[model samples]
Target: MRLPPTFYPALHDRVRIALDRAGLDALLLDDPLDVAYLTGFAHFPNERPVAAWVPRDGEVLLLVPDLEREYALDQRAAARLVVYPEFPGERGPFTVLADAVAGAVRRVGHAPSTSTGRVAALAAAFPGVEPVTSDLVGRLRLRKTPEEITLHTEAARIADAMLAEGARLVAAATGPDDLPTETELAGHVTRFGTAMMYAEHDDVVVVPMLTGGLVYGGANSAQPHRLPTADRLRRGEPFMLSLGCAVGGRFVESERTFLLGEPTAEQRRYYQVVREAQETGTEALRPGVRCVDANRTCLDVIRRAGLARFLRHRQGHGIGLGFHEPPWVADGDETVLEPGMVLSSEPGLYVPGHAGYRISDTVLVTAAGPRRLTGYPRDLDDIVIGA
Candidate 1:
């Protein structure tokens, strides 16, 4: 799907304003998403590194490897395209990259010097050129535009539908009868997530977390993937699943915990605490509220519930093109909650032997408090799979 032409102009304007503020003549973007944001061209950065050099007042120039020249041209990503072909034994890709940078910027300002080593290499090419590492571009990206919010809302809808269907899949399965092993369950969840993304017209679906049972629990759960096992779905076992997918380069995250059967008193208590904490966090999301304040709301609830130590990670993070971004809902983040900022409010309590519960949802900061994008039941009663 092609993004609106105004999107690139708006992005260029933001960069130009930021550059003027920082006294920069040009901003060189080597990050794929950053490039795509400024140039509407989405290509693999690993295979062939591409850079978009946006001048403060002129046209944008896209420099790409010769093999990717046609792809860049097809996208019409830039006013001028500089293609460096691979001569069997000539200078490397850096030569083409350095020339492109020199041609675009008389003097560099607010150029990205991280991510790819090329950022620093380009700086070294010009002896007197000043290389500045300013996050102005990133800061500009923190807030979503109206169009971006629309795509995110659609992504959230897709995620919500998948999680709801996945819940039903778990509820209908009985141990050794209709239930699959942990490995099988993980595969099923991954497949279901991918299918849902395709159904929603998304080209790619990144099925991050799909695991089951305590076999692969430990710190591995923090990572996206855990190997599924053959452990049967016992009557009262707690199953946790977290999934994230992107639509049109915008991302959304959703997590759900299901109980195979009725929960014990202890399980019910823990789940209730987590749910309350999640609610507290979500309630705290509003325009003008500090990011840390929302996190404290959830943290305070967890501490009062006597599960502070088990709260390993931050309350949540900003959700956008990347799964994890800035304006983190943690203790020290002072970024004010502004309208158009979308974030995840996930408060989880994990205990090794007993149980773990996480209630998460995508929230958009709006004029009237925060709008919940993912509509799923958060109550403990709603989490139970089967009787």
Candidate 2:
């Protein structure tokens, strides 16, 4: 996805700022998302050893595989593109990457410890070069830019459209003794929602997750995935749908629970608790507030509702290029919320014999307050699929 014109410049400024704070001459970014964030080129990192070397001054250098030279050049106008052929025997992309890093600065900061092998190889090649850990580079990317917020807002709009279509399909399919299989219903929703996003042709849709019934409840209780099954929708069963979509490498996440039929008293109470907890968490989002307070707010709501034991996970997490990012909304995280920070407020409750209800939405921290990107209704009354 091609980023907005302001994105790369803002990213460059952020990198320079980070470099100054970390006392590094330059930073070597090898991760695909990091490279795209800095250089505005999005491609599979595994295809080539692509790296972005950003100096405290001067233009950034994008070292890419020979095959992707043209594509990289077309995508990134600000960065000087350097191409290297396939690695020869005993010589890997690290050689070219090291040369690129050496050309940028004397001391280089590596992104993650996983890049240690590449860092060691570069140090071996350039005996005098120093490699330092600079995770702060990623920390700098935790907050979004105005342009990023726009892109993410567009992504959220697409997600909201998907939810609307899914809801309509569910309502239409529901009738007296006219239940559909989980796979069938999920396939319809996924096809429609994915098509709506892909029609824009600006961003690709990740795998859509739709699961239903007791099996789905168990799977969601364990973890989230996209493997919907053939379980037929029945009366009083709960189904959960989670979605993640990206635009220009920026991601938005949303999830909602739906009841197949009229919920029982216990189920209604549980859903109310989950919804209230989510509301509490979302309301707590604002600039300068501690991230952990959001989690505490939601947990406190759940605990007061007498379902604390069913709460199995933290309130939410940071949302950006990746679905799950840093600066978690959990206890002990003292990171103050900033105006551009985006987060998901997903507080869930799962009981062994009862049901699971989770509500999630991507929220952007704004000067006024937290603005929810997804517009689907969060009320329990609106959560029922059909009568």
Candidate 3:
């Protein structure tokens, strides 16, 4: 996984700028994506603690556990590699990191999500070092580089594949071999998505955010976030799915409502409303557009249709290194859209006793217009199967 040639150097410069602007000498990063954004090392620290130190004017130091040494070295994101032993090593991991940072530490900023012990260690190491929380990492990563954009675009392809398979499985309801139980089909989608992802980028190890998909039908479809159940698919009802696939450690959302058989007139009406709402959200996406407007556009259509109550949650979310990021498209979020910012355009509706419908497309905001990277059609007719 080779990072762009200028990625590291440019990021270091930005780090210095962020540090200077914050009136801090250095920023310590513990969040995996924060570190990856700067140094290209995307190791999930989990229980094993890892810290990447970015001094205002020196080489970056990565204090990582011994287990991640090989992977860390592969990325070459850090200058001084401080490899500490496992948890029960001669010295505590935090202490070792403190000793390293204390050498030339002053006022420093850190990830707010850092563990309490780690934050305390840093505070103790540099007693005079004023501690402060800064979302500089997230802010800096908000606008993606070209490499990042390519990674996200590719990830969206996997989502498209997953959606395609879901449509196929549901469309072939009558064929026993083609039809799979809700749980079984969810598993198949995961396996198939995994296989397809590996095929696209064999060498790159992509950690999928989640394996099992949300497969619900009949009464369960009424629940917005319900997962797959053992109940089999039934004709004349909506088969909804929220599937996923990842590439380059990035993910995108591809959610669509499926109709396994001929749908009822009511179902068609609801589907059309939701699909139009989703389009409104996507069409509203562009550089310089307000996130609030984008979100409102999605709901406004439903509101006009007198189904606004069924429109739950925000319209969408920012997509990048993680599935969900900043600048959510919802009420009161005055964030302005910018070129290269990828966001999901998901708008849905549900009635507890009736079926539900939603369509999510991972959209890329561009100067010209919004590009829907996840290319599955959202039209009610397109999604209708087994007619």
Q: Please name the candidate that would achieve the greatest lDDT relative to the true structure.
A: 3
> How far off is model 1, as Cα RMSD?
3.6
User: Judged by TM-score, which candidate is best?
Assistant: 3
- Comparing 1 and 3 by lDDT, which wins? 3
**276: Cα error in model 1, Å:** 0.6
lDDT of each: 0.71, 0.74, 0.79
TM-scores, all models, native as reference:
0.87, 0.89, 0.93
Worst 10 residues of 1 by lDDT: 207-216
Worst ten in a row by lDDT for model 3? 203-212
Instruction: Give the C-alpha miss distance for residue 202 in model 2, angstroms.
Output: 5.6
Error of 1 at 136 (Å): 1.3
Ranking by lDDT, best first? 3, 2, 1
127-181, model 3: which lDDT tens digit per residue? 6777888888888777777777787777777777887887776765666455667
Comparison by TM-score, 2 against 3, better one: 3
Give per-residue lDDT, candidate 3, residue 162: 80
Comparing candidate 1 with candidate 2, which one achieves the higher TM-score? Answer: 2
Q: Which pairs of residues clash in candidate 1, taking residues 3 or more apart in a chain or in different chains?
A: 183-229
For candidate 1, give the lDDT: 0.71
The digit string of per-residue lDDT tens for model 1 on 17-134 reads 8788888878777777777667766776564557777878777788777887787777767447867676322655546656655344456754354554665566665556677777
